[model samples]
Structure formats: structure tokens, C-alpha cells
Target: MIDYRRIGALLAGRREGYCLPQGLYNDVDVFDFDMDAIYGTGWLMAGFTCELPTPGSYVSQMFGKWPVLIVRDKQGVIRAFHNSCRHRGSMICKPGSGSAPRIMCPYHSWTYEHDGKLLAAPRMGDDFDKSAHGLRPLRIEFAAGAMFISFAENPPPFADFAEKLEIYLGPQRMDRAKLAFESTISEYANWKLVMENGRECYHCATGHPELARTFPVTMSKHFDRANDARAKEFVDTMTANHLETEAIEGDWWQLARFGLNRGAETLSMDGHHMVRKLMCEENQGYVGSMRLAIDPHCFLHATSDHVFMFSAVPVSPTETLVTGKWYVHADAVEGEDYTVEGLSELWTRTNLQDKELAENNQLGVNSPGYLPGPYSRDAEMLALRFTDWYCNTARAYLAGRTAMDAPIHVD
Candidate 1:
């Protein structure tokens, strides 16, 4: 049996502003704890809303160990539910995505509407309560057209985070974007290791030559807002962009844009736009890439031409599945507007490189000789912040506190 008390003690003992102890990444008990403390209660990226454009379209995946189905109802609303059939507990939707009139269980033919209402369960007695047998619903929230699902009975308020996220994503028009391509890769590393490696680009200089062509090595380090002039300038520019966006869109959110170091306008081979058309009128000229890191699972990068999204899902103590999606303008044509090769080149290469790095790091950390190391204050600040957030959130959950009550660790 797993010792919850022991895991709680370990979480409390974690060192602040540094990498976690090796056991946290390699122990089976600790991995189970992580599935509960991190993936269980937090809001997680499901997929882009655009993926389910037509009514009855659906996507299914495992959210932690829970089988989840995301579907667009006939009313054009996206809803998520436990993928199990209410009658016999068989999976209602298969893995991957497709369009369907209704979800019918392959085992017993129990049928449900796209919104999860129980429609029929043949041969049941008249006394049976069909209304009581709907698929279990999970809480869902949206930000910049990305669907976020929460398994917690009482999930945190998404308004504050969504409000801020809109500012960074509004000009990109993610809601109107269409899926260009998607790829999934499995990494032989703990989920946290995958997240930590992605939180910073310190390894990009040596690990990802193709990605570094447009990404600046110097800009990878954490900036000091109090002392760094460039940091202040970036903030000022974002503020100006927010104001300009609010003036045009009739709504404003806090902190909009930031400057990218390289003259490269977007994530591509030659440091230029990958698509012929651009989003938002203000972005007639290259406005630089806008990035957002939603802790625990999702990372987003948006340019005038397209948006790239990444989600990290834990499969086991030693394995994680990383999914990447590229979104372009819904009207974009493959032959004339943008090529998939051009849109996916940078992140596809970077993702493969980071997979190797994380796997190598996990192998070392899994060894008995490995020990916790100090985090670099400059280059690895984001990684440190990520660890801090994880520890704090885990501690709070163990103490029976509200998940959102933990300190906000932002970049």
C-alpha cells in the first residue's frame, strides 16, 4: 500500500528554489502521489476548441488514469465526460478522434448523446432510472480557444488566469485557427523531467541547432525586472500593445506583448513568416512571437502566422507522452498558404532534442549515485519556479487546502 503520510512528509521537506530530490522522480509511490496532487486537481489542456468544429465531433484521451472524452454537441458547445459507459463501464469512445452521431458503448450498446445524457440502454426494466445514468461530467474552461479540463469536484477559478492569457493570445486569434498538424512522442523520462527541460532553453544552444536558428541564446535566461532595462522595455511594449488591442477589440486584459531577441519574426527555418496570411490587423508587420507557459501541462507559442501548443501527459513513473499541435488560419490552404514542413520545423526538432535530454537526465537521476543539484539563478529560473510551484501545490493539497491558494509563480 502507498503511504500518503510519508509522501506528505517528503513534499514538506523539499528544498525551495532547487531541483527536487531524486526519489520524487523515480519512486513509484511518489509518481502515484504526483498523479493525484498535480494532474488530479489542476486545470489541464485538453486540446484546441477548433479541433471540434462540427457538431458531434469528438476527441478522446486518458487524463491521468481517467478516460476522458471531449465532444462538440449539436448545440455547438464543447463538453467533456468520463469516457466510460454508465451501464456496463465499457469505454464509450475509443482513443483518438472522430465524428459520431452519439457515443455507443461497444460492449452493451448503451448509448449517450454528445453532451453525455443517457439516451438508451436496451432491455433495462421500466423501473430503471435513465436520467441517473449519464456519463460523469468534468469541469472545463477555455482560454484563447484552448480547452482546459479539471477532474476536481471543486476546481480553481479560471477567470483570473484566462483574463491574463487573453491579453497574450488575443491578437493571434486562436479561436479562428484550424489544426494544421499534430504529433505525439513518448519520452523515457518522468513527466516532471519533461516539464523541467521545457521550462528553460539553456540546452537549446547545444542541443537544438535548428530551433536556435531563430531563438536567441542570450534571451533564454531569466530577466531581472528591477534591474534589467531590457526587461522593463519588454513590459512597456506589452502594455502598449494591450492598450492598442483594447482600443480596437473593445476589451482589455493585463500585459499583452513582449520582444523577441532575434530579428526572426516567427518560428521557422529562415527566421520569417511561414504562412502567407497574418492574424490581427496590428500584426501587419512582424510583432515577434508571444509565448505562454501554463504550469504542469501546457506551453504555447503564437506568432502572427500560427500557434504551436504542447501538452505533457504522464504515462508512468518512467514515461511521458508529449503532444504537439500546430494551428494556422482556418482559411489557409495547404498548397498556397503554408506548408506543414515549414510550420512544424522548429518545434518538431526542438521536441525531439528535448526528449533525448530529459531521458538522459532521468537516467542519471534514477541512479543511486545521483543527488539534487542547485539550480542556476539566471538560465534555469523558470525551471526553479516550476519546481517551487509543484512543491507548494502538492504541499497545499496534502494539507487539505484549496489548490488555487498556493502562491502564483509566474515568469
Candidate 2:
């Protein structure tokens, strides 16, 4: 049996400025708890609006154990629903992108509208209520052009984070963008390892040579920007260009715009725009990359020419699926405006390197002599924050569970 109290204690016992206990990385019970407590409760980035361009367009994917189907209705509204059919619980949509006038269950021919209303149920009695058998709906919200869904009964407020996303990403005009390319890679590492590796640039200099060519790795290190002349100058330049320069962070999200290396326009091998057409109409010259991170699942980087989105999906106790999506102007043609190889090279290489690193890290942690080590105070602050958030969230969930399990006295 899993000991909830012991798990809570383990989370609460984490030392500051250090990595988590070894068991937290490889324990099956801990992984299951995380699926329920963390990913289950948080708002996850489902997909972008461009993925479902026309009415009836939809994409289905598994968020933890929840099969999510996101679709555009006849009225042009984006909607989400549990992919399972209302009848015998078969999946209405397969795991990928497709288009259909209505969702149909291949097993029994039960059909549902794009808005999740039950439309046709053959061979059912007149007493059967179609209204009562509609598909189960999930809570969904949009920020900029991306869709976020929460499985929680009462999810956290997204208004503030949505506002921040607009401030940083709205300028990109993602509504007019298209998903140019996408790829998913399986890593033999825990989800936390993949996230911890992404939350910092401590390994970029030594591990990602291609990314370092254009990206300013030092900008990721935590420091007092107000007193730093370089930071002040960059902010001034961006402000003069009518761009957002400040960084905004909350408990579960962070958004910031940072300058690239000198003479670099975007994140590319040649330091030039990959797409011939710019993403934002007002962008006449170089505009820094706007980076946004939503806790527990995804991170996004939008440049003047394109946007790159990354999401880490937990697969098992010792495995994660890291998916990358690249978006560019909808009118931009593949060969004429941008090539897939050029558009995805920098991040593609970096992700592969990080995958190897994370797998190796997990292997070391699985050893008997493995112990938590100190995180670099300056370089690994983001990683520290992520770890802290995970522990705090887990402890809160465990505390709630304990309270519910406790015996009540007669009044």
C-alpha cells in the first residue's frame, strides 16, 4: 500500500537549493500521485488555434490518463471534451489531428456535434434522453492563440496569466499563424528530469553549441536587471521599438522578453529570420524573443518571425514525451518562405542533447549511491522554483487527503 503521510513528509523534507530525493524521480507510487495531484489539477497547453483552422477541425491527445478532444464548432468556437463516447466509453477520436462534420463512435455509430452535444444514437428507445448523454466537457481557456484545458473541478484562475500571455504573445498574431512543423521524442527519463533540464540554461553552454550561437545564454541567469546597464539598455531599445521588455512572473507562470546575441535576428544557425514573412506586422527590424512558461507542462518562445512551443507529457514513472511545435505566418509557404529543416534545426538539436542528458541523469539517480546535490544559486534558480512548486503542490494535496481520511467527532 502507498503511504500518503510518508509521501507528504518526503516532499516537505526537501532541502533548499538542492535537487529532490532519489525516490521522487523513480518511484511508481510517487509518479501516480503526481499524475493525480499535479498534472490532474493544473491547466495544460492542449494545442494552438491554428491546429483547428476551420469548423469541425479537431485534435485528440492524452493528457495524463485523460483523453482530450479539442474541436472547432460550426459557430467557429473552440471547444474541448472527453474523447470517450457517451455509450460504452470507446474513444470518439483517435490520437491525432483530423476533420469531420460530427464525431462518430466507430463501435456503435453514436454521434456527437462539434460542441459535444449528442446528435444521433441509433436503436435507442424513445425514453432514452440524448440530452442527458452528451459527451463530458472539460474546462478550456484561450491565451493568445493557444488552448489550455484543466481537468480539475475548480481550476486555478487564468485571467492574470492570460493577460500576461497577451502582453508577451499577442503581438505575434498567432491567430494568423500556422503550425509549420511538429515532432515528438520519447525520453527514458522522468517528467521532472525533463522539466528541470528545461527550466535552466546551466547546461546550454557545454551541451548545446548550436543554440549558443544565437541565444544569449547569460540572460537566463538570475540577476538584478534594474542595476545592470546591459539589461537597462536592452529594455530601452525594445521599448523604443514599441515592444515589451519587462518580465512578469507569478506562482505558476513566467513571461519575459530578452535580447538575442548581437547581430542575431532570430534563433537560427545563421542568425537570420527563417521565414521570409514576419509574424507580426509592426515588426520592422529585430525584436527579441518573448518566452513564456506555464507550470507543469509547457514553455513557448515567440520571435519576430516564428514561435516555438514545447510541452512535456508524462508517460510513466521513468519516461516522458517531449513534443515540439513550430509556427509561422499562415501565408508563408514551406519552400518559398521557410524550410522545415531551417525552421526547426536549432531547437531540434538542443532538445536531442537535453534528452540524452536527462536520461543519463535519471540513470545516475537510480544508483544506490545517488544523492541530491546543490543547485547553482545563480544559474539554476528557475529549476529551484520548479522543484519548490512541485513539492508545495504535492504537500497541499496530501494534506487535503489526510484531512478527509481523519475521523470526525460527534457534535
Candidate 3:
């Protein structure tokens, strides 16, 4: 149904390093046909590790359109299981999160351990082996403080993926930060738009005045993997360990960028007490700690003191549900200062800015008169890369190819 060779050419490009025409962003058909590029194949960070801090914790989450459950077993190892009942395919867990030694299917009361081992099922003939009907398990891996699950059989290991993209992520992913709060929203634009918008900071010069006041726009350019040779070498180092961010600089935005002096903090062994105060003065209120990423479909904003990740899950070609999770030190959260209001305000503002623009832009693209607008190279790169990846991956899926099975190319 699609031309794989032509799609590869669009992604490979002739002169733009790597680029695609604007039609990908405008076509409704593209979204409908290629939904799996996002919902399938590549890794997705689902259900934060902190949410399942102890053995026997389980949560119901969705992998794109399919529902999934992640559980921590008695052995303290986490596992992913399809949440549907083995009998009528009814959903087993109704709650979003909780602790249970064995998951009881609501429809027929079949039971499975948190590790996804099928322990017992109701009403089956004696000859039916419960072991053969265990809840199906997915490939699972961890990076820093977060966890990722993939449905594809034998998906690439998290360590292998990270090792290929090394230095980009410091040493470990910032997963240890305890979750303090979560914010969820239903966005009206495509999920890819949200991911693309967050990837580059070029928009900070205008659309994000608050962020611009904190970090230089140049940092976004520095982050680009195309022009920087160090970036390529760094990605290689990362793939060696499975790409994960090792440190939380201990500061959020403006304060971290300026207060530490880039050179001193660049190679420093510690980020302890990363920030005494957030970027804004008391009048603006301390913005609070955060971690940032636009990987796959996630826009993660994190800090050692707090962590929040926003993902736009596409409900259809035009609608997406945006969800956020907040994390903090276990003590800070269970104790006195775990309010999500301060950090939430900052995220909402930035999120609304993009939501407003993207939804309106979508409407315009729906009209027949829309034309390709000139894009600034920097802020636009994030969106551009998403477009490239979306088209390329879709074609790859059509051809039965995948990011994991592709030739390793970090070097």
C-alpha cells in the first residue's frame, strides 16, 4: 500500500542533512495509515519505575491502542503483561495502579501473579493447563529512573539501545527520583506535533520567553545530533550502555545553566544540591526541579527534587491525550513539601502555548489554501526530525523492518 523506497528517499534527503516535505504534517491519510510507527516497533517509556517501587505493585497502562499492565514480582524484578483476560479477552485490571500479589481477572476471576505467570483460571476443563495460559509478557528494560516496555517479540534490549547513543545520556537515567505528582490532559493535536515541538529550543526566542530567560537557545543547537561530531561519538558511547541520562544536574532551567558556570559543571562528578532556588526570583516563584526530553512520544521534565513527564497519546488522527507524571524523593513526598502546583503551573503554560498553536495550525492545514511556511532551522528541527522519523519508520514497518533490526550505525 506504500512505496518503501520512495519513503526512504524522503527521509535520506539530497541536501538538507535529512528532511521531508511539509505534506507529512498536513495529510490526514498519513496519520491514519501509519499509526503503528508510533504505537509499534520503537521503545516507549511506560509506567514510571517509582510507581512500582516495591514488589507486587501493578498498574494498567496503554501501549498506543492496546492496554498493558506492568507488575513488580516477589523477586523484585519488574515485568510487563498484556492486561486482557486469556478467556474472553476482557480486561483483567480496572485500577490504574495498586499492589496485589495475584491479579484477578474481573470477567471470570482468573488469577495471575504480578510476574505475569498464569497461576490459575476459572471454569476451564481439567485438561486446560493454566501454565499455557499465563498472561503474555512483553520485553522490558530500564534507563535511569524510568522503565520502557515493548510488545514486539525479542525487541532490542534497553542496554543495547543505550550503548548505541551513549554520551547524550550521562551515566544513568534519572529514574530514582520519587514521583510526587502527575498532570494529565487531552490535547487536540497529533502526538507527533507535541514531540517535535519539544525536541528543539528554537521556539524559545519567541514562543517561550520564560524558558529563554533561563537557558540559551544555543543549547538546543548544541544538542542536535547532525552537525556535532562529539554528538555522534557521544551517541556511540550511549549505545554501548543503552541510552540513559545518568545524572540529574540537581538544578532546573535558568539557575542550573548560569549558576554553575558551564565549564565547571560540564565534567563535575556531582550535582548535589543542584539548586538552592529555581530560575525565577521569589516574585515569579521558584520554578522547581525538572528533567527534559522529547524521546519517542514523551516530553519529560524532571528534577532531582521533582519529576514530570508529558506524553501525547494519539486517540485518532486529530486527537491526542496528554499525560504527565510527577516524582520526588520518597521522603519529601511522603513528608512536607510535595505540592505539584508550582511545577505544574510552569508546565501548563508551556504546554498550552504549543497546544494552542498546534491545534489551530492543524485546522489551517485542513483547509485547502495552506502552504509551507518558512521554518527557522533551530526550533524547527525538533518537529522536522519527528516528521522524518515518522515517515521513515512507517515505511520500515510496512517492509517488516525495525529500528532494532536495522544495521547499527552509531559510529
lDDT of 3 at 369: 75
Give per-model TM-scores: 0.90, 0.96, 0.73
Clashes of each: 0, 0, 36
- Deviation of model 3 at 170, angstroms: 7.2
> What would the per-residue lDDT of candidate 1 be over residues 1-411, giving only the tens digit for each residue?
556666666666577766888878988998787888788877888878989989999999886567899999999999989888888688877778889998889988988988888899899988889999998998989987878898888776778878766666767787788889999999999999999998787777899887778766546444333455755665565555552211111111122234555477777778888888776445353565566676688777777788888889888898999999998989989879989988898888889999999999999998889878888887887788788878877776766732434432221
What lDDT does each candidate get?
0.77, 0.86, 0.55
- In model 3, state the lDDT of residue 41: 65
Candidate 3 runs further than 4 Å off: 1-29, 154-157, 160-176, 217-220, 224-294, 401-411
Model 2 segments more than 4 A misplaced: 220-228, 281-283, 407-411
> Higher-lDDT candidate among 2 and 3?
2
Candidate 1: how many backbone clashes?
0
Worst 10 residues of 2 by lDDT: 402-411
Clashing pairs in 2: none
Candidate 3 global Cα RMSD: 8.3
Tens-place lDDT digits, model 2, residues 129-187: 99999999999999898899998897888999898888878889989999999999999
lDDT of 3 by residue, 1-411 (tens): 544444444344423434334445544554544455446665677846778878888878765567888888888888888888787898888638889868888777888877676778766878998777888887777655467777666453456444332333222234444555666666676666566666666665687654544434555432433455644454454344343323322111110111111222111123222223322221122222223443457755443234457777676666777776755555553324534555455556767777776687667756677554554565565555555566555655644643434432211
